[model samples]
Target: MKNSKLLIIAAFFSIYFIWGSTYLFNKIAVTEIPPLFLGGIRFFTAGVLIMLIARFMKISLKLSKSQFINSVIAAFLFLVYGNGVFVWALKYVDSGFAALLASTQPLFVLFLLRLIDGQKMQRKSVIGVLLGVFGMYLLVSQKEISTSEGSVLGIFMILSCVLSWSYGSVFVSKADLPKNYLVSTGYQMLIAGFLLGVSSLIFKETWISPLSWSNKAQVSVTVLIIFGSIVAFTAFNYLLKVVSPEKVATSAYVNPVIALLLGWYLLDEQLTEQSVIASIILLTGVYFITSRKRIAKIKVTTKSQKI
Candidate 1:
């Protein structure tokens, strides 16, 4: 593909709009469908679709046993715990609020590096972490949200999901996997979907026919599977190859804003003054963290769907 201006714009649109829209979509779907089951169907269908596309494109699907194992591990951490649980939290948390919280992923990544890798925090990263912590406090301390039942638990779970995603980003950086990232993503999705599907059953979530789903749930799921899971990811990879890493990385800052606006407009989600202020402070912190030299690889390795 040529590095045409129009192509770049479209790719950015895919990553920014499609990914931001996913938060709203998941929120809509989870109102009716159980979260794990919703995750199962979305990822499984997306996995199959991506794998078929890979095959059609003549990309090799073969992986060594160890690679397959690593794929499963990545899937478990990233998709099952990170993304699936995050979706479950949407049952209680507003989509925009969750998106704002999830933006702290880069902070978690830096913290993990400091803990596990013994990497010294850069001055910028330190500042970013401080701001991120402060912003998070502001975000979660709202009286309206605190009064809502389950919102606190939902916020806690979403933060944990961010940690899971951060850990997975570190894992994928070192893990042996398929030569092609799309193939690796496909493998991860397939394994994660199956695991979450079984978990849904183990947890006794009711499964219903797709035809029985509410119109909104069905549309949301379709958008999630096709645009959120597949198309946005592909565009992310494409942009990384064609543009500067810094430019591609802007999605992290842009996504929460888009999510906030979309949620307010489409779902009638509240956008408190604290939330607006928190979003700015948090994204500023994220910018500081991601602006450093060490954070780029983690951004690249993190899932197409998550923080």
Candidate 2:
């Protein structure tokens, strides 16, 4: 029991920190490789590698018919629409603006859970979501968003991605997925990757050999496959089982702060006072949501023990 709790904590930390670092790496990768192709390759490679590891560890990869269909649906919602469309949208929208829009995941997840599963929202969750939105707004410079040349269609696409991701997150929590997280994730990634590959072909993206990619781009892709896909995504799936979807979605709030800090460290970007304040506020909101979930978990465990 203690080990399970410890693993959950570790999983949260991995998603919070590791996924944050993926933004810069993804930016680098998508610069050279086509967005759809990049995503396809990244997820495909990660899925295969993870599945292989699981097999070596003697984990069953079998899936029932329902489980297979559920994995496919999740793959489409989470990876295909959620990520693929966002990648394509990046061409038309500024990254800062896109990040701001994607940060709406918690709000979307909150209402989706309520509407779909009839879960009631706590007042603290509502306050936390509001604070998170405000903090995200401050984190990205308003001047930048206003000045950037973003297409209306692109903005709409990203909003749709946010909705798809939020809905998928909630759906996965209730879906009849495989008993093993690794098996389910592997299938999800593989299915999404194949669909993305078809998208690349449809768009007529010329395949570039991985050997020809720049050292930095290669490294970025590697990091994304390992940390972003395997570690962080697996952690996210595990969290959905234990934590509230709203709390898991709070990672979106932290990701922008991580990007900003990375920008400061790597590119020497100015860390404005507003950015610092926003980070604090964003983290505080995350704390509130996470603490609420943690308290709920403790209560449930205590009740079970008493029974």
Candidate 3:
């Protein structure tokens, strides 16, 4: 039990740190490689590698028809729209800014949960969502009272990314999938990778030879495949099984912070005073929305214990 707890802690650290650094590496990679192509190669390689690992672990990789369809939908929503668009938009925006914008995912998930499942909404959570929106408006539009066209477009794309991911998250919960989380994730990545490869061809993106890629780009892509996709995602899957969903969801908040710090330190990305204030506002709002359910769960557990 003690060793298991230690492993869980290690896994949490992996997801928190590795996932956060992915935004930075992705920024480096997309500078030279086309977004879809990069996404294709990254996910495809990671998917294949992880599937092999799953097999070695003796996890069943078979999918029923319904499970396959659900995986397709999830792949389309998560990798195609969610991650692909965000990666494309990184060309025009700062990585830290992109991470900050993407942090609104929890708020979007809250809204989607209410809309789709008719889940009761909390007034505080609604307020938090609005604050996040306002903070985003300030962050993205500060260049002009009305945001610069490029910034506006990038912000919009990131929001769409958030929405796609949020909806996918909800959908996957109810969808039939492989019993093993790693197997399910591997299948989703495989499908999304194929879709991304097709998109790269459609757009006529030049596939740079690996030898021609800068050392930095090569390293970035490698880390993205290994740490970001394989290790971090595996950590997330393990954490989800052992921890409460809300505890696992803390990544939504921690990732942006890690992203922001790494961007500022490594990439020398922008961190203007206004941007700092906006990040605080945005992250705080996200915290409220994400934590609300956890708090409720704690209360319920306490009451039941008393009974």
Candidate 4:
């Protein structure tokens, strides 16, 4: 159990760092590679690699018809559309800006949970949502919003991505997952990757130039695949098994900070005082909103068991 806890912590940090850095990496990759195509290829390669490993492990590839259908739906919402929006958004926004906008996902989830599960929104959650929105306002205040050539479209796309991802998370929790998360995730990735590839080909011009590989780009892609895709996801699954989903989901708050710092240092992106203030406000809001219910639940459970 101790080892497992350590592994989960490692996984949390891996996801937090690798995923945070992906926005910058995507920005760099798109400098030479087309957006949709790059996304499609990345997922496709990762999916195939995961599938191959599963095969070697002799994991059962079988899925019930219902599970198959659900997986396909998850792939569409989570991978194809969710990630698709991010890739599209990166074409217009700075990496740091994109990360900041994507951070609003927790707020979206809070609203969705309230509506769908009849979960009562605590006062703290409402306050948190407000703070998060205020943070967004601060973050976007300095940038000129323009649909034609700037962060405007990017912001919209990233918000859409957040919504899609939040919805996908709910679906995953509700759906009947296979006994093996690795198998289920592998299938979802494979199906999603294939669909994304096909969609990219139809919607955008594809490019893969051997000469386009810079040392940085190569390093970025490799890191994203290894740490971002495989290790982080594996850790996430492990954590989900042992920890509450709410705890695992806390990474949503931490990821933006890592992204901001990394973007500032590595990409020479500017971090304004407003950005700092906004981040604090948003994080505080998130803490209040997300933790209240969990804390309540824990207290109730303990009382009931003691009684």
Model 2 lDDT per residue over 34-108, tens place: 989998999999999989989999999999998898898999988888988887777777565576677888999
| Per-model lDDT | 0.77, 0.81, 0.75, 0.69
TM-score of 1: 0.82
**Candidates ranked, most accurate by lDDT first:** 2, 1, 3, 4
Better of 3 and 4 by lDDT: 3
TM for candidate 3 is 0.81
Q: Cα deviation in Å at residue 218, candidate 4?
A: 2.3
Lowest summed lDDT window (length 10), candidate 1: 298-307
In model 4, the clashing pairs are none
lDDT of 1 by residue, 196-287 (tens): 99999999999988999999999999999999888876565555555434345445555777887786787676878987897788678757
Model 4, 29-90: lDDT tens digits are 77776766666777677778887888999998788988888788877877788886687778
| C-alpha-based local distance difference test score of model 1 | 0.77
RMSD of each: 4.8, 4.4, 5.7, 5.2
lDDT of 3 by residue, 77-128 (tens): 8788889889999887777678767767766676665666556667767766
Candidate 2 regions with alpha-carbon error over 4 angstroms: 144-148, 293-307
TM-score for each prediction?
0.82, 0.91, 0.81, 0.84
- Residue 160 in model 4: lDDT: 86
Residue runs of model 1 more than 4 Å from their true location after superposition: 1-16, 141-147, 233-254, 270-277, 294-307
